[model samples]
Target: VCVPPESVQPPPGSHLPHLSSRVMANLDDGTQIGLAMSRSIGDPEADRLGVIPDPTVEVMDVGALVQEAAEALKVESEDEVELLAVSASDGLFDHVTPETVALEMARSLYEKEGAPRPLLAAERLIMLSSRFWIEPQQVAYRDDISLAVTKVNKGGKVKA
Candidate 1:
């Protein structure tokens, strides 16, 4: 819910929206907003500028995923995961690639013992983002690390 589309691709020959980078949307007044995403839950100012509260949803068969990972990893032990779901704000997404997040989650879940540690996976992803992306900056800034990792089983049980 935090990353904007990065850049808006206006249709064929149309003009782009009048906005700045990152935040994307600009106000009618001489105001530069720091709002992150193009979609938000509740922000009247950003809403006026075309940010909607709509969300994108996807459904998939985690059984197939489980089998696929079992085959790929070649170890169908108890640590074999059913599903790994990562939800984060722009802080993580901007700093790290999806693959990096996936690897971190996979390692946290598979390499660790006992029940899937989605919380640890989430923490690792956040730390990874801050450590690699923000810590090396000349002027370090704090972005809200709103993230969660969820493990969903075949029986629709969720653990976080």
Candidate 2:
């Protein structure tokens, strides 16, 4: 359901397209649901030419993702896993290490958003990094991680 800016334009001489209303509603909803990636071109020439940047929206079923991850990791319950989503800004490169960036993000979430910090301290941490741009646009990468905690039983044994 990717509604590019170019695709949402009204026909020449018309007030609005028939599908514009529905598309706008979907895009707005996607943005609120964290399924949309909005990026603007930083090139001055492109901006002067009236280039409108469109957002890329992807809808994901989180339940299905958790189930798949649990199976892949051979975990008994999905409740043992936590998902962390973080976006890297232009200043991210100033950090010394990826771990530092991750820790800062986690701390911010805990302090600002009141997110539980213990979830971030899970035993297994899977980091995924994605680069969106090559240059000027900051060459930013969005990092997402799945953290899972394996429960331990009495007598110092790990429970499956």
Index of the highest-lDDT prediction: 1
Give the per-residue lDDT digits (tens) of candidate 1, residues 1-160. Answer: 2234545445556665333224543568966556544566655665556676556668777777777778887885635545668777777887888888877776676564653476766776788778765566645755666777665666665456
Top candidate, metric TM-score: 1
lDDT score, candidate 2, position 137: 43
Off by over 4 Å in 1: 1-36, 42-46, 75-81, 110-121, 132-137, 156-160
> TM-scores across all candidates?
0.58, 0.30
Candidate 1 global TM-score = 0.58
- Clashes by residue pair, model 1: none
lDDT of 2 by residue, 105-141 (tens): 5554445466445444331122222232223246444
